[model samples]
Target: MPKLRLKESLAGLKKIKININFKKKEKQMPIPPPPPKPIPRGLKIIEKYPLYEPFSHVVIVQNPKTGEHQYILDELQLDPLERGVYDRILEILLAEIESPKEEILDPRKFFAESAKKIVDKYRISLGWLPDVSWYKILYHAERDLVGFGKIDPLMRDPNIEDISCDGVNKPVYVWHRNYESIETNLQFPADEILDNTVVKL
Candidate 1:
């Protein structure tokens, strides 16, 4: 009877060892790492392209859970100091702009030249502006003066056909040729800005 009980205990111990070995083998198998999480509400960028060279770009993103595509404008982000300088330059340029003596054939080039002159004139007083800031400032000045301001990227996109905005603090939706209606990052945070944009439009 003692021998039988010892044999039974040894058999049970052997079974336990076999189970432990199985677990060890499982751990040895190469396990693929889990995919990294998407940020800012699970948005995964699928495609990116430049609309305006160097300064402005657009990204196509998909929501993993919803699989909805969105268009996001990515432009050079300007700090407060750069914005202040741009604002000052824009004000002076607007005041100094003169009507062309003849029909302006190349309006974009004309506005660009005017902006460059103002930037050069105030270069000393504005201190040393970084190259990125210079491009960004010039882009905004040209965009507002010659093209649409905040919605210039959307306006320039050949794929987009229509743009709609209900009111202030609302996301502007655009009709894309391929994606249909897509909500954009553009919105008027204040009434004054919206009014100004409307006047410009």
Candidate 2:
């Protein structure tokens, strides 16, 4: 009798209805990058090798027309976002980086350690950056700070005894231990760039 009463009372209640809806937000996809341009006929790469593993490489090229050989230093290139991060990190390091404690301590090693800390601290502000970009910025920051700015790879190379730049828009020349003297593909495109190179050196 109680069970029948319960069923009769439940049947007295009205049926419930639910409205369900799902909406997805639209996302704008990134544009595809342009294809690489072809290498010009004037220059041809003879040999290529890594100078700093993933960060830097060296390319030897010769002009077929002039039979002139040149050395090119290929380093990791950062995009706009990565470049911005690199610039900011460098600015902070330049102001706050510590000097060597002892004369015997390697300045490069000390600076690199400090710079790594700064990079780690600054990375918090940079959200969703890829490792490639992060490493590119780090490499550039270290390159500009403790290491030689543009020609750090060349400096590391034991074969080259001397490096020289004549003037703006002129190729830098390196006195290779084996090849003697040869021009480098690195050239100062403008007067200010040449001045900056001098200051960096």
The candidate that achieves the highest lDDT relative to the unseen native structure:
1
Clashing pairs in 2: none
lDDT of each: 0.63, 0.59
Stretches of candidate 2 exceeding 4 Å from the true structure: 1-39, 189-201
Query: Against the true structure, what is each candidate's TM-score?
Result: 0.74, 0.70
Least lDDT summed over 10 consecutive residues: which range in candidate 2? Answer: 1-10
Tell me how far candidate 2 lies from the true structure as C-alpha RMSD in angstroms.
28.0
Residue 40 CA displacement from its true place in model 2, Å: 3.2
Model 1 accuracy (lDDT, Cα): 0.63
lDDT of 1 by residue, 72-157 (tens): 88766567998898888777877776646666666666777776787788888888877667777777777776655677666667
